[model samples]
Target: MLSMPLRLRPGDDLRGAIEAVLREHGAAFVLQGIGSLSVARLRFAGRPQPDVLAGDLEILTLAGSVSPDGAHLHMAVADAAGRVSGGHVAPGCIVRTTAELLVALLPGHVFAREHDSGTGYPELSIRPVPQASAS
Candidate 1:
């Protein structure tokens, strides 16, 4: 396992940045994240669409798994008034100031997303990396 500390700058897409890391590492899990965001788009529980929160928002918590296919992240944020809201992290969550994240990279493993008939959504699939044979 490789632990990576990442810092995201302003105007960066939260999900996109994590996805980039996943693309490089193959499989990684976001242990935690703390930062500020100018815009947060989150899909509440059982909601088909994401609610957009515009303004200065503090990232209370962020964690999830990211695979080569995609990422499943959950985040909680507090508004300037201290109102807290959390849900499934979606795209377009723009960083306002900075984002600090600790990611754990899993070697010798591969993560894929497959369609789950029961859930009607794509889910994570874990498998060991195939061993390479010497000629």
Candidate 2:
């Protein structure tokens, strides 16, 4: 396991930024830390359009696993008014001030998303990573 601390600058796309890191490793990883954002684009369950929240917002919680192929993350945030909102994380969430994050890399595990008949949505599938043979 490896811990990665990330700080996203202003105007950076939140989800897209994280996706870049996932693509960098192209492996299993999870976000595990608190962060703050000035802007956010969150999509509620079954909602067509994501709500674009503006102004300082405290990142209360972020939970999900990611792979280079895709990511499934949920987030909750508290606005400047202290009104809390949460939903499925989506792209186009531009950062305002900054976004501090701690990403954990699971080198021994592999993650992927596949269309599931039961869920009727792309769901995350996790498994152990294959061992590499000696050269």
Q: Which residue pairs in candidate 2 have backbone atoms (N, alpha carbon, C) closer than 3 angstroms, thus clashing?
A: none
Task: Please write out the lDDT profile of model 2 over residues 1-135, one tens digit for every residue.
Answer: 888888888888878888887775645455654677777789998898888888888888876778878777788999888999999888877777777878888878777788999979888777787788899
Clashing pairs in 1: none
Q: How many backbone clashes can be found in candidate 1?
A: 0
Candidate 2 lDDT score relative to the true structure: 0.79
lDDT of 1 by residue, 46-134 (tens): 99999999999999999999998889999999999999999999999999999999999999789989999999999999999899999
Candidate 2 regions off by >4 Å?
A: none
Quote the positional error of residue 112 for candidate 1 in Å.
Answer: 0.8
Report the number of clashing residue pairs per model.
0, 0
